[model samples]
Target: MYKLLFAGLASFVLAGCSDQSWRTTDIGDIMPPLDFTLTNEEGETVHGEDYRGKATLVYFGYTFCPDVCPITLSRLGDTIRDLDDETRDNIQVLFISVDPSRDTPEVLKRYTDAFGPEFIGLSGEQAEIDAVTNRYRIAYEYGEENENGDYLVTHSSAVFAFDREGQAQFLMRDSHPVSDAEADIKRLASQGG
Candidate 1:
């Protein structure tokens, strides 16, 4: 009987140590916690800690992106809208512009406003942007300018999700369904981390 009890106890302990099943790739142990210094859409300096109390989703993209950026933001917006009111209110989407040279504060504000109130646009000097992008392993490059001085920025499309305490949680790729994203954000919010 004692042997059976010990076996059950060990099984219970091991189960407690198991990882939570997340639809996206679990990045809790892989990525660094959320940290950055950038300017908000209102031109105010903001740090990662400013958003510490909310579950944050960070996406690196430019407002001028013709296709990928808009679609990603729209999917995130839909995910947020589908959540419960409390969970939705406790989540924020940070859109970091990779092309700060052309993405001004006013432009960022106007662009993010189209997504939803939960979406915020941020940008900064080249060095600051580079630091944050490198920290998160986000890659981006500019295409050659056209005759009209127009160019495109090729950037990584992964979105990083952080818990309320600013700890890295998971990465949402473009292929993840909106429902999966919604479920993850809901879990993060419910955990109150």
Candidate 2:
């Protein structure tokens, strides 16, 4: 009887040690296939469905954003750069501009292109942009314009990651480390189409 008890206790301990959950906190309660229509940086219309077979990292911000946007994009760039070539090929990054009034397709392209070739910029009319933002529950308030017509936008700074199956699997905050993001992206890419 004592032998049986010892074997049972060892099994329990080993099971606990082999937990498969990701170490980083995941905020992906909503399952994916999120649909949206927006204009790409090349002045062409693009649909989210076009990325159905690939993993995507979506960030909402504007070209003129003073701090948070740049920091988040830079970190994402670093994370992508650290990924292996095959993983990088399986992933795409999108920067959606909230300030469509100022971030035209050309401006958005120039801004995102600075990060990397795989990074694409997206923008549309305020209503369309609002539709997509509302779907993701992103809040952004455009500030009053100054004498030079420059303005500020207060917005949510969350970056969303979708799996190859188009399922929302992770919501990465600005505070998360680049290594953590790279791990998540690799896992998603390994899932294949």
Candidate 3:
């Protein structure tokens, strides 16, 4: 399975991304095949291969995120719904936790469930999460708890859009109404498989 995932990732990077219009400042530096080892809600070991041929939307945030995370996730769902079925099938959404201390696999899964089953939530060792965040050039830092004992994680609010081949194509900045992200996803799908 790992081998197959690795092969798929390579293919995604090599596939036709010639007309990519998204910029590094916008999408990020064109990245090579990105490999990550994370466990799904079931605690089953998963790699990038499990999401083959799918344009993935990845967000790095904690489940406890009170405002931005929920708003962003709702927008993601709206963005997905805006797409037709055929386009949606070729896409996947990943909710990865930047807060490892409390976000176990079960916690991650539950958080994602509120968003939708199609959304996959993952969290692992602090070092592992940090490494991936660094690779994507996302900035994040933990915040202190309030009087109610609820804390916040201030993080980069961008959502990354990867092509079906798993190649980075666009980094949708956290902006209003998600129409921009919706447009980009459609544009990517229209580019052809």
Ranking by lDDT: 1, 2, 3
Score every model by TM-score: 0.89, 0.86, 0.79
lDDT of each residue in 1-193, candidate 1, tens digit only? 9999999999988777653767778899999989999999989999999999988999999999999999999988887887889888889999999999999999999999999999999999999999999999999999999999999999999999998899999998878876777778778766754
Residues 1-193, candidate 3: write the lDDT tens digits. 9999999988887664634455323444555455677767787867766776777888888888888899889988876777788877777788888887788888988788887655999877777787778878879988888899777889988877777777777777765345556777677655566
* Clash count for each candidate, listed in order shown: 1, 0, 2
Candidate number of the best lDDT: 1
- Stretches of model 1 off by over 4 angstroms after superposition: 1-19
CA lDDT of 29 in candidate 2? 76
Off by over 4 Å in 2: 1-20
Q: Give per-residue lDDT, candidate 1, residue 161.
A: 93
lDDT of 2 by residue, 14-74 (tens): 8887443343556567535557899998888888887777788889999999999998898
